[model samples]
Target: MMTSKNLLELFTQTRSDSEKICQPLQTEDYVVQPIVDVSPPKWHLGHTTWFFEEFLLAPNFPGYQRFHEQYAYVFNSYYESIGKRVVRTDRGNLSRPSVQEVYEYRKHVTKLMQELISKHWNKDWNPVLEIGIHHEKQHQELLLTDIKYILGNNPLQPIYGAVSNEVLIENSEREFIEIKDGIYHIGHNSESFCYDNELPRHRVFLEPYAISSTLVTNGEWLEFMDDGGYSNTLLWHTEGWDWVKKNDIISPMYWFKNENGIWSQYLLSGSQAIDPKAAVTHISYYEAFAYAQWKGLRLPTEFEWEVAQSKINHGNRWEWTESAYLPYPNYQKPDGALGEYNGKFMVNQKVLRGSSIATPANHARLTYRNFFHAPLRWQFTSLRLAKSL
Candidate 1:
């Protein structure tokens, strides 16, 4: 249950986290995305503010007035039933609002949300507040990923995060563990706030199968490179092959080669030699699938992945599954706009269970569903090998 004070503190802190990340950017960099894939920093800040206002404020506050009626249209993301929204492709074009104005707007919305939280003051709304905070957290990550994608394209090669990602790991081996098949239930089980797709647990069938004890590391993937993994069409799905060729991709998104043929990958702080112990990241399902096929393996279905996860530390990397993103059995969405959280995304996305380094600690769970389009590789994503024994 949420006391008004606790909910207000959370809202303030989460909003502060977003602002802290934006502190590194120059005002010009905030508006650098010439394409839709990179939302202006200003937009990311205000859009999250818009979420709280739309979902929590207007519904509960008797005298609520929209900060800007134009903002409601400019920021509504894919909620067609909510009426006309700003065109997705043109979001980066709204440079007129200025980054400072967005922060002011954030302050305005935060003030209203604090007032509403106090007035309504119920435990029921606590779940709503919790989910909204995490939703903003998810956006915090996307904001970084998208900004990196945009900056990586710049000729300047600007650095966004100053902290080094240097590390030493005690475990470097990729051990494989086998699980005996049985009926199992998967999805959220009153653990906390969850998306609709992770609801109403269901059963699944499986054979005796083995999954890699750890994520496939940069060392192992390098061997695939040595074996011409990219050239071998037999290792790829038809769609995957096309995507690879179209992008001219020969390695993960962050990889580059020197004139001397030394391979390296960019970390948050700067570029570094690919570590054998670190997970192979920035990979799409196509890449994970093709790599598995090359090694006479396969990606597990969501249930098989979930069942295996119950026994392991949901750490290191998010494992891609063969399952398309969909709703679970007997799933009932939460009422109102919160219902928009997950149930609406059941189609066209692939499920990636487990967690990645970028995922916040304590948020990962066996039933947690992470998803993306099959060909997209802009995330800290990788997979484990699953094989039928």
Candidate 2:
């Protein structure tokens, strides 16, 4: 129901915000991919631009010519229907395009998009444009988190900007809020924009349970570590135990102890002592499950999280849920290349509820379903404990 002019404004703002996130990085910082999980900043810039061009302008715009022929293969990410693309691990190796050139490509695509929205506006075009806007917003969060990973892993530990790593500490004492057994309707029900994964709202029956009123804090996580939480095999799943021994895992990502045996974490602002009052972050589902097991509790199922969300204060971190990423009942993927977005990756992934500090403004919704593999810890993820009655 958004006007063309409003959509245009939103599109412009989303594009500008992405560039702003990279302003603090130097030329050298744009190309390094320290891990396979993290994409280079330069690649994020180009891939998002390619998304708009490939899906919108190329097919619909009048006589819209590509900025570069090879750019498609260079920037197309995981779209099998879009022909060959650069391998995921080799994104950082693509130094030919240069940062300046990538910016130029963005400018080219953005200008045409503006014209498309303003001059030849169509009411039917709103859905795809909205998706493009939100898709870029998604990349905006990844931009910050990936940049943090790039700089945090550097030997010099360079500062990116004035971003905060502290969680907004709630004043209330922690307690569990009980929910009675009942059927709850879940998924996006409003007319506003949402990803395809959140569509086709469905009903779920949840058992009586109690969920924590607050997230687990750094102090609590420290207690787990001091009590040998990492070394205890009984606290972890079999595969999680193998991952711990294989990687020599000790603490959450970006955490390190000084020579004096003091714990500190690297933030975008700089390295600082860990704030015990802040919520714990940068943990994987395996670690979250292990921590809950240590405390004789379990993670809430996605249904429970959604139904009890009104009572809990979330959005500080992406809370891990005891649910797998799967389609809703009668869920049908959108036709064509757009279908490739969420339907293809429904296997072997855990669902994460809530948003995080790095999540873009207005992007998180109560029905939004974020998912990642069990061992991946690069994002700002944490957990809240739950128990069955």
Candidate 3:
């Protein structure tokens, strides 16, 4: 548990970090949403501020006045319980709230939050405040990735910052660490902050298996592509095959072959040659599954990944799991608006274990369950291979 003063310091830093992420962007970059899955950068800023204002400042702070009455309807995300707001796809259409205006809104809410935490520190305020901070951290990751999508998709291929997306692999050798079959306890067992989905640590049975010691690399994926991995229907799930054919996905997102046929990828810094040894990223779960199938291997179940996590190197990218996003035994959803956070989205999504390059610091844990629909590849998602003994 953090002291209110410590949390307040962190809150101040976290709020500033979000703005720092957007500092490299031109005003026009903040409002474009290329796809439905990605939110505008300005929207992320306002939405995170709206979270603090709606959940903490308004409810807990005595005589707290809203910064703007209409701001709630403009920034409200997927919370049905929170009343009507901008539709998901139309988020980019909200040009009325200028980028400067969104920043002002953030400044307004952040000042009130600081005052609330400094003057009247409550024991109960700790949890909600912590949630708000972590919630902003989550948005911080999204803000960076969304920025990449916006710039990467543009024909000009503008650079956002001095950050590099290419991660060089120190070792190319692949090994599989074997784990014996047994009952293993999984999920978050710590006292630290975790999302509700990782709660109620529970037991799971697993068969003997071996999981990869390292993530699959761009060079390895290139072999799959060279061998017509995208064209082979036998290696893909039915829906995955349909997605491939429909979208003509010949290579991972951000990949392109120059006139000389050399592979290069767009990074936040700029376009650069693909680092063959770097861990492959921006692949959908369907693509991950197909690659695993091509190798006569399979994705590790979330349980297998958790029990064997200590034995392997991770955190380079979000490793896909064979597990579905579901509640653990005796899992209980918190009542009211917060309940809708993780519980309601549990269906039709695959579980991804570990963190990505774009993931914010201290935001991911061993038990963290990140999920997305099988076809969404805009995120910095990747895979490691596993096989039954």
Candidate 4:
């Protein structure tokens, strides 16, 4: 079992690291829209703070101080039952909160959180706090990915962190590997804390299938573009094309070539040569589906997504699948606010299995689910090619 003091230190340390991620951003770099999928850097910071405020402070801290009353309305995110939050699309307009104020807001929340943990003289101080800490870690990853997308969009191509995208190239071209499927216990085993959506430990049946040995690479995606994957109507679904047209997408996001036609991608390390071997960065489910269709293969379903990942490394990109995000059978929400954690997110989203580069490694599992609106390719996302056997 996770000890209380250790959990407290871990929570504080993780929360502090969230601030570390923001230390590299200049105020203007905080808010830029290359695409709708990214949030402002400031918004990401405050929202994570607000998460701690709402879930942990509101419920746990009896004397919790309101950092700024507007943040409740400003940062309440997707929790309809919680009341009206700042409108989803308008979070970028919160110039009043100023970057410094948001940092102070974070400080106020952290001071109280640490004080609360010091008072945890009872058994109630167990998994709920652990859950809150990991939950914040998810936001930490999102902050990094969202900022990368936001920076990638700027015509100026702003840099967010000193980190370079030049991590040693894993082999760029991936080979296909077959997976013989069978019954598997899929979901959190309750050995450590997990999100509610990964619960009720269900049995799933998977047919024999094959998954790509590596994520689809930039070289292959460029082939799709060269093959007219985007312009071809027959390759895209109705909604996918509508999304393509709405965004005026000719190529995958964040891809640009200089007059020299050398493919360079905006990466965490700033713009770098597009690695033919690197996993293609910004293709949507629609785009991924079109590419898969073009290849005469299908995207894996969630069950198959889980089955295939049950075969490999722990965290990488949240592997995209053909499955829509939905409630599982017997998927009852846990009592109280924890119910709102994932249950409310089932609508209008797609299920992504596995973890992404931004996700914390220790916290991910085969059962862990990631979801995003269909057109969202900004998250550290990629697809695993699958075929029916």
Misplaced by over 4 Å in model 3 are none
Sorted by lDDT (best first), the order is: 2, 3, 1, 4
Candidate 1 per-residue lDDT over residues 61-90, each given as its tens digit: 778888888888877777676778878788
Q: Residue by residue across 103-156, what tens digits does model 3's lDDT show?
A: 899989999899999997697878888888998998998898899899999999
Per-model CA lDDT versus the true structure: 0.77, 0.92, 0.90, 0.76
Clashing pairs in 1: none
TM-score for all models, in order of appearance: 0.92, 0.98, 0.98, 0.91
Task: Return the top candidate by lDDT.
Answer: 2
State residue 256's C-alpha deviation in candidate 1, in Å: 0.8
Off by over 4 Å in 1: 1-5, 162-172, 334-336
**After TM-score superposition, what is the CA distance of residue 220 in candidate 1 from its true location, in Å?**
1.4
TM accuracy, model 1: 0.92
Give the least accurate 10-residue stretch of model 4, judged by summed lDDT.
164-173
For every candidate in turn, the CA RMSD to the true structure comes to 2.3, 1.0, 1.1, 2.4
Quality of model 3 by C-alpha lDDT: 0.90
Clashing pairs in 4: 163-269, 164-269, 172-277, 316-356
Q: What is the Å distance of residue 86 in model 4 from its true position?
A: 1.3
